[model samples]
Target: MLKTFRISAILEGISYLLLFSFSMPLKYWANITEPNIYIGYVHGFLFIAYIILAVFFAVDKKIAPKKGIMLVLASLLPFGTFYMDRHYLKPLSAS
Candidate 1:
């Protein structure tokens, strides 16, 4: 369960980065203007998968509802999942 959650979180982060940092820009700033349908679809599916996996893991681990929700929500923002990893999921590193 832990391993699966970790992997899903990473994939979620990748999808978020691709959508915000790559796909969205391509449709706007870069003037690609086509929406890069492939990236959009990929990110959409990954986002759904990430949400499902997050719930599964939270249930299996008996995590509190609020904390679990926060973790899942992190996937929505750019670099947020990675931030969750550093601050919440993993043990803090020595300075």
Candidate 2:
């Protein structure tokens, strides 16, 4: 389950970056909205999956309340999931 969350984190992070770096630019600057459309759908799915998995993992592992809050907060920021994966998830898996 933790492994799954780790994978989800990575994917979610990448999608978020792509949305910011590629999709949004194309849509706003180039007036091309297709990429954002598809990427948005993907990012939306991954975002939801990340949240659900993070919640389940936190509950299953009995994560500290603060850390669990961090996990949710991480989902909101760019590159946040990558940071969370490195600092939070990896240590748990290593155990």
Candidate 3:
């Protein structure tokens, strides 16, 4: 479960980065909006998956409610999931 959650988080983070850093610019600045449409859908799906997995992991591991909330919140910010994975999830999984 932890491994699955970790992989989901990483994919979610990459999708987020791609949507904001790549797709968004292509849509607004380059006037190429198709990429945003596709990337947006992918990012949205991954975001939801990440949230569900986070809740599942938190409940299964008996993580504190606050930390669980942080896990969900991290998905909202660019690169935040990676930070959480490195600083929080990795260590938790190791133990």
Candidate 4:
């Protein structure tokens, strides 16, 4: 489950970066919208997956409420999931 969460987290982060950095530029600057639309859908799916997995994992692991909140909050920031993977989820998996 942790491994699955980790994969989801990584994919979520990548999708976010792609949408924010690459797709958004293509949409507004160049007036190209298809890539943004596709990436947005993917990012939306992965973002939901990451949150659901985080909630389940938190419950299963009995993590602190603050930590669980951090998990959700991390999703909103660029590169934050990687930080959570390194500093939070990896330790949970090891335990």
Candidate 5:
């Protein structure tokens, strides 16, 4: 369970980075207007998967519903998932 969370967390982190980097060029760079459609699609899928994985982990581990929902929301905020992993998940794994 912990291993699954770790891998999902990493993938979620990378997906967030890709989304931010891609969005910058998409909005600001007029010269380089073309966006990587494939990357966008991949990140979208990964984002969904990451949320599903988080829910599964939370339910299996009996995490409170509110906390589980917060964890999912963290994925949407910049670097929030990293903070969640460090503070919320690390100690769970340690035990």
Candidate 6:
């Protein structure tokens, strides 16, 4: 579960970056909307999956509720999941 969450977090983070950095720019600057639509759907799915997995892992591991909330909240910010993975999830997995 932990491993799955870690991978999901990374994928989710990448998708978020791609949506903002690539898709949004393409839509606004290049006057193209197709890529954003596709990327948005993908990002949306990944975001939901990440949340579900994070909650499951947190509950299974009995992580503190505050940390669990933080984990979910991290997914909202750019590069936040990567930071959480490195600082929190990775260490938890290592042990």
Best by lDDT: 6
- For TM-score, candidate 3 versus 5, the one ahead is 3
lDDT of each: 0.78, 0.95, 0.95, 0.95, 0.80, 0.97
Clashes of 1: 0
Q: How accurate is candidate 5 locally (lDDT)?
A: 0.80
Model 3's TM-score against the true structure: 0.96
Task: Give the TM-score comparing model 2 with the true structure, all chains together.
Answer: 0.97
> TM-scores across all candidates?
0.82, 0.97, 0.96, 0.96, 0.83, 0.97
Ranked candidates (lDDT, high to low):
6, 2, 3, 4, 5, 1
Write model 6 residue lDDT over 1-95, tens digit each, in one string: 98999999999999999999999999999999999999999999999999999999999999999999999999999999999999999998889
Instruction: Write the residue-wise lDDT of candidate 4 on 1-95 in tens digits.
Output: 88999999999999999999999999999999999999999999999999999999899889899989999999999999999999988887888
Backbone clash total, candidate 3? 0
Give the per-residue lDDT digits (tens) of candidate 2, residues 14-94: 999999999999999999999999999999999999999989989999989898899999999999999999998899888
Better of 4 and 5 by lDDT: 4
Candidate 5: pairs in clash: none
Q: What is the C-alpha RMSD of each candidate to the true structure, in Å?
A: 3.3, 0.6, 0.7, 0.8, 2.0, 0.6
lDDT by residue (30-81, candidate 5, tens digit) is: 5453455666777788789888899899889898999999889988888878
Error (Å) of candidate 2 at residue 47 is 0.1
- Candidate 6 yields a Cα-based lDDT of 0.97
